[model samples]
Target: MWEAPEAPPRLTVSALTAQIRRQLEGEFREVIVEGELSNFVAHTSGHWYFTLKDAQSQIRCACWKGTNYRIRFRPRNGQQVVCRGKVTVYAPKGEYQLTVEAMAPVGVGEQQLAFEQLKAKLAAEGLLAPERKRPLPLVPRRIGIVTSPTGAAIQDILNVLRRRNDGVSVLLYPAQVEGAEAAASVAAGIRWFSENPDPDFPVDVLIVGRGGGSAEALWAFNTEEVARAIADSTIPVISAVGHEIDFTIADFVADLRAPTPSAAAEMVTARRADLLAEVGSMASALTKVMHIRLLRERQALETLARHPVFDDTQARLRDALQTCDELTLAVQSAVQNRLRFAGWRLERAGNRLRHYPWRPYLQLHEQRVSELTAKLIAGVQAQAAVAQHRLAQALTRLNTLSPLRVLARGYALVQHPDGRLIRTTEDAVPGQDIVIRLSDGRLLGRVAQVLPEPEAKPDPPPHS
Candidate 1:
């Protein structure tokens, strides 16, 4: 009967699926879908599989590697996304899915998201640590620059370098700084300088950057490949990206960051006026130190001249000479007294002899008196000579003990600023002021450094 309006044109399961797939692909070829991502899987074949779901419904999605390269941010589960793609069905499973051609996050920009993701990854790997950052050279002889040859950045840098220091050499590595191919070009320039260093004109520092622009125009510097190249460079890198307000991934990875290309040039070269100022400052400080030293030395000399030891030495010498003169006078006085007493005795004896009887006896007595007088005179002369010898010896010993004599023999007396003598290393410390007393004058100085005493060897192990 109409019984089977003759199941006219029966179709196989494969044919049914093919018909459905064609219908779905043709109708939703250019559709846009908004949903939350879930169950994302990145296959080894570089194809992405995931589910796009909303509170009310869900659909399967696939993104091939060839098409997903345009997506800037990495996809993750639970992220809301807006996808532009076509709908199709897998014939084998007879299931339907959306083939994603392009995609982006719902609220954030693709570049910003990509930047944050890369930043987090590099930070986790310790590339952003302050300890990893190297210091730029204080005085760069030759500066290497990587930037666009025709852009304003190169002109600004060259002008700054010329103005700051004409002697400093500059080598330019022309590179593309803004576009899809810019990252590789910039990285190649940096690696070229790093790999091929010029011995005759060595590049002391590197500047990699561009002039200010919109975020999209400056996206090349924010790329991970450029960042890694900067980090891997052996030479110190200075990142001079956009204006003061702009920040890029290269800035964080570089050894130093400059607000602008001109600022980087200024940092690498020293101004002539600044150099002269520094030299003048050092000279002024030295002159001041010398002036202070001379004043201290003059004061020290005046102090030594007025010391009590010199006065005491002079007083002792005077006293010794006075005692010698007193001893000489006393010896002469005793000799004179002895002569007078002898003469008196002789007169009395002569009178007694004249009154007494024998003439021969008187003559004999006169001879004896003359002989005794000569002997006593000789004894007094010997005593005076002995006294003179003792006095001369005493004067010589006193002269030998004089402090001035010691100083004249090239010995110096070291003392602290507070007038205490410095006898050992412990009494003086580095940077301490000290006075050195010489024969002619005194010197004022400061201790520069201190060294520890060497450990004494144990007598060579008793000659074992």
Candidate 2:
């Protein structure tokens, strides 16, 4: 065939633009592009428009508010990110763009962004207030640990606690400390320990979190639910989330932040050797203080012994002799006065004794007392006899009123087998077992038969 001029493809301007747009959209759909964000603009109409670029190439991207809201952190122009989105074209301008569905910071990952977001939020809510923090118990009776049962974190904490203070008991609330369900499981464990505290196994402090890991591995602690659970916990929570340098949301919300699990255990325990050393130091200081006080007291006694009055022995003896002489003279004067008064008293007593008739009076009083005593004894004996008779009568009446006496009089008490009193025939079913109690014995019986009394017939009415 002869070479012919190529026919120009014929299309209207609108159709051409549409065709190009369809081609671009088909080629760029569902792409994951890695680049630094730039020219970022979040519109009032709830759409994000940005440009993603590396050193070599650039592409326009758009994320609707619905998807943007799901992202954990703000997307800034300088942030390097990997975005997953579908390509679409602005038909009017025929410009190709990406409709981003999800995005994450390239090096930091979504988990890290989530952690920072949660940390910031809880910090703003004052969950991490310094005043809200509680001191770790000096010696926790039981420490509750929430972590992976098989993890090194638990082992490390156990080792530290055991070495520091073996007296404290550790109660494990084994939970997944990483992965998708970690937050919920940790919160559940905290709640369980709180609600069902054991009497003998009560937990005084809670140690929560795992060993050091990547941001994704430690994301469970970043969850708001986990943070709030730690904040709301009644028992003090010591957050041991990661290595010494790592920090998580739980660390801020917790009552105390431990750099590592081992450190948290140390915070809760006291070393035996350290305590003994402190005691020894205090004892030594106390002994020194006592020795100094005793020495000072002895010196004061010696100083008093060396005083002028104690040193002048002969003068002191002479003063004592003079005082004795004065006391003897005073004693003699007092004795002479007392003797004179006694003589006068004895004379008066003798005259009174001679003038009185005490013997006759004493005989008369003795006779009266003897007569009254006889009357009192007779009255008391008579009253006692009357009381005894009344008491005998009361005893007889009480005996007559006794239930045992009624049973002895041939009256039996009927009761259901269950011990309820059976007062009427209706109380016993035809085949029901019953107990009959007599004065000295009980009989268990079953109803063999029941017969009702015949109804009385009414007399015939008078003849009308």
Candidate 3:
């Protein structure tokens, strides 16, 4: 024999799958596939399975949970996206597909596209309606802030608040301001204020914002989730993301929007602050109003005072004063004439008295006084005797029923310290203080004994 029998080389399914996997992997190590997404299925395991198809051709693509979950913008069905990932053949299926390391929408700037898409979606749901907006509190009692704990946003807000002497309570809910998790974190902060509201530090308004940054840095605010959170907040929300020139989807859904984080603080307190700052102007305005009102009221009163009715009443009062003056003069003349006539009569009477009435009248008056005095003595004696008889009779009747009379007849009244009369021995308690009232005075004594009444001897067994 010249050579050993040659063995046939037949490849197994595993070997063929392996060869295809290596060959496809080498050919498309790093790939950028641009196509419209279709049949997208986000598996429960967080893996995204979809078809990248165009008008002419189509290819299968898979975004692993590990790689694709990092993408910020959500990939939708029929959305034109550029997927960048390594092309690898799935060993089991022997099909080649993009791994989808990253993805972005086509035609528009990536950030702008995401922003517009979310804006439209939210607008359709009425989250962007003016009716959904809430007015800033006239005087916010508490203001909740959602931003990075150490970021410049919080510092700016605090500085502004300090400058204005913002009396409203501030509660800072620290969350990442710029990152993949920033949107969810911001949403969580809104929900925290909306749900776990503290009665002591109750959040009346929310300021969700960050300092100025690039569009990508503030992209978290454009997220649909964060927008929905702002829309659904029970408390009024103020969106203050980026600078004045930059706008986000959050600004559309929030109850209010500020150009910057510091501006948000000023806005929350602006109603009260503006009024306080222009206190002089307001005072002037009020003074003007009061002056106008006073002028109007004064004119009305002056018009009333000038009425002919009042003038007629005043004329009548003047007439009364004139009549009173005339009467006064007439009374004075009449009094003077009466005094002169009385003086003449008194002079005539005095002359008569000097000539008449001497010792006879005095003697007669003295005799009459003596007679009346004797009569008065007799009447006084009779009244005294009648009063004395009635008094004796009243005393006799009172003595019969009086407790003092009973006590004087050798009876004693026992009374408890509380002033209750003790009727029997059972009413007395040993060692308790009591009072015994005799005829003259009350004697305080300690109760020595309380003897119980003896029981009858069973009534002699009461007849069988």
Candidate 4:
């Protein structure tokens, strides 16, 4: 009945879209949607586009790189996920879509899913093999630690190390142990220790850990960056992250795993007293071996001296004497080599124990090493002197058995013209030519006397 209603206000396509966008954004400013993910696409611009659908309907969603970076897990097609976002209309497409701010797995935490995924991936790469692990140094001169400088973990480690008073030089690399940047920081610390070892005191091992904390707080150690850092470290790494029950990827990839930071510190340092005792035992054993060898050499020389064959065979005696000299030289060389090797080992141990800000025990160690060296040298010298003296006496005894000395004592050797010895009166005829060899000179003459000898008288029986 009224005049035709004024034409409804016409809207441009852009205007319509703007109006719809406003209503949708206002109404769905924040929402959480759960569905099966499909048509997933990660754009070159670092944005993610996907469809979330159920049996009945579907909705398009976009996760900008800025927002998706906060998501712990990677989104994949056909996965059931929960997305939180706002709804807005696209002006060009005339469609409403979700601008996803965050996302997670439908039933599990994103962090847990990510952890599992990384674990499986690394396991497949053989990084989790027990054979990949390396043994820690028996004694570490410098220990490189990665953790929060202000945290209880550092304090706990320091307390443990101090309690033992192992005199291990510790180099701390301050890093965030929690939060998003923690993984990067920890990895950087590990890599720094690996690439840039100290010129004077290189890091012997690395300790990567933190104080016990909640799962969220300890997740940095669970990340790929930190795990890879531990795996690739040139230095042996001990992963001491969280309490005994809390495990991280770093724990699996590290060369050794400790349950806590304090425990890690304890594990790294061998007791100085125990190591010194071991060194002492080794030295004592070596000394015993050397003494036994010298005794054997003396026994051999004594046996050779007592043998009657040495008195008759001058060549054999000379050979025996030469052998004795050789043996003596060999024994001397062997002792020196053993002592040198032992000294090398001790010096190496001392270097490891020689921590920075030199501890008092270091001086004591130096003294002990010097004393041991002197003792070894003195013992070797004493043994050598005894051997030389014995050898000289043996040579003197051999000299008394010399034929020249017998010849000098009014004895002479008669020889035939052909240089054969004249032993009996039957062989030495009156006309045979003979030579008389004396200590001073030789005489050539005809054999003029080969007389027969008279019978000698027999001895009487002993009186009862």
State which candidate has the highest lDDT.
Answer: 4
Query: What's the lDDT for all of these models?
Result: 0.78, 0.73, 0.73, 0.82
Q: What TM-score fits each model?
A: 0.45, 0.45, 0.43, 0.53
Off by over 4 Å in 4: 1-114, 123-139, 146-156, 163-165, 171-204, 210-220, 224-236, 242-246, 259-263, 270-300, 303-355, 395-423, 426-430, 435-451, 454-464
Model 2: CA > 4 A from native: 1-112, 271-278, 308-464
Scored against the true structure, residue 452 in model 2 reaches a CA lDDT of 64
Q: Write down the TM-score for model 1.
A: 0.45
Model 2, residue 232: C-alpha shift (Å):
1.4
lDDT of 4 by residue, 30-127 (tens): 99999877667789999999888776788999999898889998876557898898998878899999999988887543455677899999999999
Model 1 error, position 30 (Å): 24
lDDT of 1: 0.78
> Which candidate model has the greater TM-score, 1 or 3?
1
Taking all chains together, the TM-score of candidate 4 against the true structure is 0.53
Please identify which of the two predictions, 1 or 4, would achieve the higher lDDT against the true structure.
Answer: 4
Q: Would you list the clashing residue pairs of candidate 2?
A: none
lDDT, residue 282, model 1:
49
